[model samples]
Target: MVKHGEEGLGFEIVKAVLNGDIIEPITFQKVKDYCSTSGIQATETHMRVILSNSTKNSHSPTYKNYFERVGKGEYRILSEHRRQEKYFWLNVDATSYEWSFSDLKVGRSQIYSNTNPNGAKRKKETCFKYIQIGDSVVAYETGTTKAITTICIVENKYELDDEIFIEFKKSVDYDLYLALESLKANGDLKDCDILKNHRGTLFELEKKHFDIIRRMLRTLNASGDNEQDLHEKVKQSLADGSDERRARLAKRDSVTPVSYETIVRVFKRNPDVIAEVLMRANGICEECLKPAPFYRKFDGTPYLEVHHRIRLADGGDDTVANTIALCPNCHREMHYG
Candidate 1:
């Protein structure tokens, strides 16, 4: 807390100067200029004390973490509450826009077609008007391949006579693209403007939606040999089917050469063991106590599988004492569920 006697015109000056500049570092002279413009009287030392103290600095006297010193005579606002990073989705149609993902990677500003040139000039319903520098942006390829292919940070943005242009910094293109179906399955991005209203070129993405897509991209692009990587790949493969990859596969022969197989060695159980287990169940599942779904076509007997209380692979004997009859549903649940 700023002590009762500590907060003066300098405290107000600091607050006014650092109101909205969260990412960029501001110099001491900038703070001084703000104070002068606002008609607040404060010395340089007083301004420094408040700016340095904001809890992020370990040596700060005040119990606050509002500001962080970035460089010599420069500071930026500290997101004390761990604020979520702002994210935007840009729809890039190569058919209409001359600039491509390559242009963004080379630090060229992207220009989108503007329907109302006068509206952009007047800042009325303009797409890029509210986008500030340092915001995260995901570029989605539209028209043909519907996937998010590039991620970048907004370096600068402006509205021209008939178009809105925005520069990107640290733009990156991942090997994997996040398809629309994959994103929708991962999060509630279907509600976003890009899907709900496709006419718009730029749309604000919710933090949750952004987090989901970013995580999937990072996990897919992660380089390592781990169990989790395999699981993520399986999940991603289930969710996505790339047109190019599918086309390549379609050309190849459907049946490929058989390779080595994994066969589990098992003990040959006595026929009487299964007979005894089935006889004990009396046409009912031992687990769920439900009757068998149907009778066998050949024998007219209840359909059931003899399940060992302890799996045969786990060293259980092939005795009736260690076996029970289960319907197909219960048998599948025992193995998978």
Candidate 2:
């Protein structure tokens, strides 16, 4: 019987090179030995081809020089992230994963996953950093079908790779396997290998498949959940959710028109105050300290305008102390500018 591993032979070679700390380029023997111990069945000639083909002519299709050739028949893996096949799903099973990730409650939790294959781990602690915020997670219930479980919200504000927080919504149903079955039955999931029983803590799925899974999850609600309950919850949690709170913040920033009338009391000017202040100007604009620009058409005086030092709208008294004669330019500035 042939032993099997999910990653193919070439990938294992890269893993071996990464596992090594030696300064010298990885030789054929090191990869061959790693493969043999790891249950990788391949011919010595096959290993030669794997090495030679990885560096030669750059196939750009299969195991291309995504690796660096250091010396004759010696190479190092480059673009390790690209070398690993990107998965369409991310596994979130903390119990089996031994608290690899905490369940999100009220919208935040730190996410972490085991770094395997010895190579990728050295590059980064875990595959957890590969997942960005807003990326969907397929959380399996602890000690169960290794299936979908609950909805956990990733906070918009998270410390990169270290302090990720997720909040679990109140919709407490965990029968995501049924939803999975529905997806498979409707030609949704079975065609995709990402939905299968993949080992390791973070099973990845494609964006499209993840979107479908999220849509399926949306249709499910917790026991005794209702629209009224959800409405109140959303209202209450608005201050609590970063996503919704950000939306509200944006809404607040956006221009909004409000209509109302204020009943501010008007102070009857003493008329004497206006006369005295205007006289004090003496054919000059008191504010601009320049002679009046033009004579008033009606009064034929220096045309300096009588104005309030402080606007009545601001609760300033209608007294000479609060008045300043100004030219039309300065008057307009006082009123509008």
Q: What value does the lDDT take at residue 238 in candidate 2?
A: 31
Query: Which predicted model would earn the best lDDT?
Result: 1
194 Cα displacement, candidate 2 (Å): 1.1
Instruction: Report the C-alpha lDDT of model 2 over 189-300, residue by residue, as the tens digit.
Output: 6667755555555544675676667666655433333433533443354335445444544455322222121111123333344455656787888877999988756436
lDDT of each: 0.58, 0.49
Q: What's the TM-score of every candidate structure?
A: 0.40, 0.30
Which residue pairs show backbone clashes in model 1?
A: 54-64, 54-65, 55-64
Q: Which ten residues in a row have the lowest lDDT in candidate 1?
A: 257-266
Error of 1 at 322 (Å): 58
RMSD of each: 19.4, 21.6
Worst lDDT 10-window in candidate 2: 256-265
